[model samples]
Target: MGLRGRWYRGGTSKCWLFDSKDVALHAPTREEIPALLSAAFGAADARQLDGVGGGTSTTSKAAVIWATPDADADLDYLFAQVGIGDPTVELGSNCGNCATAIALFAVQTGIVAAEDGMTKVRMRHITSGAVLSGTVPTPGGHIPKSGLARVPGSNAAGVPVNLSFHGPWGQNTGALLPTGNAVDQLQVNGRTLRATMVDAGAPAVLIPAEEAGVDLSSMADNLSGSLPTLIAARASAGLAMGLRNPEDPPQNAVPKVGVVAPAGDYIAADGTTISADSHDVRVRMLSMLAPHPAIGLTSAVAVALAASVQSSVVADAAGQAPLPGTGAPRMLRVGTPAGVIITEIISDEKGMVSEVALHRAARHIATADIDVAQAAELSA
Candidate 1:
């Protein structure tokens, strides 16, 4: 069978988005969605040579979208992290970068009618229960075929999308600090390390680069060598954050794990010299097992929110002063191997987050019918 879907580049990653109505034609039951997506992406093969999967953690993502009748949201999307060299389709977390793409997809496909200039669409994540608002640019009520705004990790340009999260705290574990503490001392890989486990935007754990035994200066070579250590730290944080039990195996999706460091001079992926004061915080988050080419939008929000918490590992790494108690919004500049990305954070009188906004770019890549003829035949 063929399933119709659209491809898009949102922020730093590429994702394939499909309508539930079209997916249902091929998969009659919800239980079959994972297998269907896995087959279409050639999930079992590491190279994904037989299917549309990009053979990497970032590109091997899909989401089933549909217009919602609910009052709180205009549309809903269930994100899928289709495995590479594995057949699991994880739906445990939300993705902000993909949400950026969906905003444009909605406007282009008429799911949300384009206003004259900026079109706003509110989206709800079915898995993580996060509400996102995306503003799409439409000049003369039309989404241009191309754009000039470039994402931090890529040279390619696309239409800009402004995405904001409303009340993003404690969606999964019922508190911004999942462990009831901003920082925790956990035993990982036979070493006790300090970590901050936050549940905002997405569930994530941040560790200092030194305790994680990684050198951010030589990121590429250091990350590949420290994969095993990174995995251990992530698994430990997940259990501490109550994301999983001892019986449950390690999850590659969440809580998103990474090492953080104070701003320092380093070379970016594009061979550009990044100064110490150029950004507020430095992060090297893992997508699956490897270091993500750039930070994921959901994780980026988590980092910013964690940075606001006093004395947290993320907050300590932040080179800037404490966020004001109740005043003007602040931009938290994050330094990644790709480049610098900015997230605007607004705090209320109680020092709690009022809202967090991330600016990203998205554009339509391609649309076609994906061949998943054997999807349903596989046993669920």
Candidate 2:
């Protein structure tokens, strides 16, 4: 029998949940994990109709979890990104939304005390061995089932989630800029382009849409409809970030693309309209696969850092407004399709970034078990 799941979402993302017992994972090596995850998601077509995948990279996710042996951590959380139009499942990255689900899952499962005070959860990301600390709201001695907080893309009101990661810069790669610079000029389409490359929550290439010649300020609806030029821009960005192999465009990976501009009026994905003056910078976060209407946790972190620094895309809009230099905690409010995402970053004067904090203002919907043992049977 198939395991039960909820395609719930937080901060503009969703995932397929499998109870720890329902799924079984046995990979002799890390390289084998992606296929295993794709199978668990039961992806038969590009849409993954046979499984819980929602057909988009944001919704196409799988989480394997179970109680852990550590006292500080309640459960072990593993996340996988099954490609939208492809069979490759990437396990090298961490999903902040999935990470949020893990913390909420713990309280809903009674793995931890859901008191009125903040519920602290320490989770060891199996892929990275990185310990993540998360705090979710508990109301009336229970995990708050709902709240009124709303994000750019989410419709429901529930207990907003707060997730924090220490040393998020270069999370998978090991350097903030990864290429050792805040800004890099790349040649694509026979034109020289400037991009701010940062590896905060994920590898991202930030460009000013206006400077790139995309008049986002005048676009009636966030520039809907994809063009070859846009796709080429994104593809070229991925290669410049060193995430894609020059020899194999067919086997390329997602490096994420975003265009920033001064704030202006626009419609959010949820149909809620916003004025550019409502945000510090008009920001759009692109997933490796497509343009996300909103932003990702790590990308938001990178935007916050870039906004603080001078000469970068974000900096061009916000000026050289100095943030707390190096190790000083600061917040960056990004205007997106969902509304605004405020991310915090801790940095030092040495230009080294250490931690990224994401404050999501969305209510916790609910949590259910997926029977991990059952999900594993679908693994190839």
The Cα local distance difference test for each model comes to 0.87, 0.66
Give the best candidate by TM-score.
Answer: 1
Clashes of 2: 32
- Candidate 1 versus the native: TM-score? 0.96
- Candidate 1 lDDT over residue span 287-325, tens digit each: 988889889999999999998898999889995556787
Query: Model 2's lDDT to the true fold?
Result: 0.66
lDDT of 2 by residue, 242-273 (tens): 66677856222345567788777776666667
**Runs with alpha carbons beyond 4 Å of true place in candidate 1:** 320-322, 373-380
Clashes of 1: 1
Q: How big is the positional error of residue 197 in model 1, measured in Å on the Cα after superposition?
A: 0.5
